[model samples]
Target: MYFSGLVSFLIKYNHLLLLLLSLEFMALSLYYGLFLFLSMMDYEFFFSMLFLVLSVSEGVLGLGILVMMVRSHGNDYLMSFSFLW
Candidate 1:
């Protein structure tokens, strides 16, 4: 699942929304793997909780950027931005 998300991210770079979604997908897969590892190890779940919190915050930040991009540029296409040069 993680690899699939990465492939999507690499192949779908035309749109900011698609990139963010792929990133979130990758993060979710990592969270699931971490949770399983912790469970099998009989370790505390605090780390997993922290990881989830961080991933959610990261997703929120990405969405906020997406919103700003859409509002200013009128679309989510990455190529819509003008070059600084």
Candidate 2:
């Protein structure tokens, strides 16, 4: 419910790029928070590095998808994806 609400809010007022960015921010924050918690327990940076690497890869993939979406739709608005549903 919370995530759906966030998606709706992002769709209603944000550009597609902004939507992707916000998603990325949310993911990174969650991962980094975990990493910090883990670090405090054992001072290990490995988990954070692993998550950072993963997040970057996820970012690249998301960006590639965004590019494809824009090319196919010619616009970056959430409403433009109505055809998908």
Candidate 3:
């Protein structure tokens, strides 16, 4: 199925949320991959968990910045950045 114009627009403009979601997808995929590899090779899972935690923390921080900016400016457009200074 293809996304409609509104979905595409959201993905284009809501970059921070999009990035966070992408990171979450990556982290989940990596965990699954690591689990499969470990089942085959017999290694510990701590490293994969660590990476997942780091990605989550990064997403949290990124979303926090996005929320703060939106709260301050009342807009999510890139043009709002000019008001930063």
Candidate 4:
């Protein structure tokens, strides 16, 4: 699932929304794997909780950036932004 998300992220680079979605998908897969591993090993869930918190913050930051990009450029297309500008 993570690999699929990565592939999509790379292939769908034309849209910032798709890239963000792919990143969220990858984060989710990682969280699930971490939770399962910790549970099976009988370890504490503190680490998983920390990871979840960090991921949520990262997602919020991504969305904020997306909103700003869309507002400034009127769209979420990645190719619309030129580095040489």
For each candidate in turn, give its C-alpha RMSD to the true structure in angstroms.
1.4, 3.9, 5.4, 1.4
lDDT of 1 by residue, 3-67 (tens): 99999999999998999999999999999999999999999999999999999999999999889
Return the lDDT, model 3, position 65. 82
**Lowest-sum lDDT 10-residue window in model 3:** 1-10
| Candidate 3 wrongly placed segments (more than 4 Å) | 1-14, 83-85
lDDT of 2 by residue, 1-85 (tens): 3365467546655476776676677776677678769877887787778888887998899789879888998878766688755
lDDT of 2 at 54: 87
In model 4, pairs of residues that clash are: none
Residue pairs in candidate 2 whose N, alpha carbon or C atoms collide under 3 angstroms: none
The digit string of per-residue lDDT tens for model 3 on 1-85 reads: 0234335445666454555555556566667777789878988888877977887887788789879877987755664587643
The local distance difference test score of model 3 is 0.67
RMSD of candidate 1 to the truth, in angstroms, is: 1.4
Please give each candidate's TM-score.
Answer: 0.94, 0.69, 0.64, 0.94
Candidate 3 global TM-score? 0.64
| Shift in Å, residue 17, candidate 2 | 1.5
